[model samples]
Target: MLQVISLVLENKPGALMRVTGVLSQRGYNIESLTVARTLDPEVSRMTIVVDVDATLRQQVVKQMNKLINVLQASDLTESPAVVRELVLVRVRTAQESRTAVLKEAEIFGGRVVDSSTEGFAIEVTGAPEKLNEFIDVMGSYGEIDVTRSGALAIALDARKLKLQPPVPTKAGVKMEETAI
Candidate 1:
């Protein structure tokens, strides 16, 4: 089964490498991975998609939490979340196919970001399946180049994964454990 795992990590060099290395060492395949800085510049969020069994998914989450740079990790497979991927496609356009291609692109909520006598560059953002369908339709028109941003997702409502700092005890010492 495919699972979406989200992680919040400290924004620092080699943080991504550590996370990916752990997964690679365990022989897990990453279907998609997207990372971007969060509103807080000190932190970054990563959304990773991997195909694995439920037990293995839990193991991956646990391993992620063991990393010092990883502040929070959560499996969003069954959670209420919003996910999307962006795709930019430049398609060859002939006088006979230009109108048809534009109409089809409009049906998928794609915009003509650029156009020339040779082709039109269409930008589309939506669920992965929608983008795949659009690509199939545009294939007949000829694709010159294509670039895609892997899936990015965030949980809905108050149900989200977050990092909390350890509380101080009566002894005046802060705990080292990370709060999920």
Candidate 2:
């Protein structure tokens, strides 16, 4: 099973290494990891995806939480959350296929970040599966180079379930937020 684990850690040297060390020491292979500073400069958030059985999932979370700089650790695989990834692709295409390449990128909602006589550099962001499809389409164009940002995810707000003042909607119809 693939488990998504989110962690909040103090922004200190080696904090990330320590957290990854715990997992590596246990022989867990991380599928993807994305880490960045949060609003507060002193803290950083990390989203890690790993393949592990149910028992191993529990052990990974427990070990992560025990780390000194780790403020929190939660397994988000079982929670309602939104997850996304970003990819950049540079494709070298023949003049005859340039138009088709750009058209395909537009259809995929990709932005042409850079362009030259040699090729086009496109940026796309969405669910990992969507990016995979986009990459496959881009590959058909010609020789290409690709780079990806690992998955980033956040759990939905549980407080949204509580009774509260009605949220205003643009067209007077209530809008519901659903996790992706």
Candidate 3:
């Protein structure tokens, strides 16, 4: 199973390295990771995706918390969340296949984010399975290149989950659905 672990660490050198090193030392392969600053300048948040069995994952989470730099770590796979991944794809399309490509893109909720004489660059965001289906369907059209962003997850709750010094949320972003 893939566990998406979120971390909040101080903005300093070697902090991220320590966390990654702990996982690497344990031979856990990271499938994806996304790190960014919250509203605060002193802290940064990270979402890490790794595939590990439940029992060992608990151990890993314990070890992660032990790290001085790690403020929070959780197995979001156990939470009710909506997961999304962004894909930027460039496809080789001829004049004859242009319409077909556009149609497929629309069917997949993708848009032509970029275009050139060579081809088009499509942008799509969806669940992992849906993204896989979109990528698979694009293969028949022509040569394709793709890049994906790591998964980010937010838990839904009345209480603010702290991975570091807590950050506040404004109005409108609710707790009903946690986006992963």
Q: Considering TM-score, which of the candidate structures 1 and 3 is the better prediction for this target? A: 1
TM-score of each: 0.87, 0.84, 0.84
lDDT tens per residue, model 3, 127-168: 877888898888788899989887877765432556446566
Which lDDT tens digits does candidate 1 get at residues 11-93? 99999999888789888898899999999999999999888777788888999989999998888888899989999999987
Candidate 2 wrongly placed segments (more than 4 Å): 158-180
Residue 81 CA displacement from its true place in model 1, Å: 0.7
* Candidate 2 per-residue C-alpha lDDT over 24-139 given as tens digits, one digit per residue, 9 for 90 to 100: 88788988999999999998999998887788788889989888788888888988999899999999999999899999999889999999999999999998889999999989
Between which residue pairs do clashes occur in model 3? none
TM-score ranking, best first:
1, 2, 3
Best of the candidates, lDDT: 1
TM-score of 1: 0.87
The order by descending lDDT is 1, 2, 3
| Candidate 3 wrong stretches, greater than 4 Å | 158-180
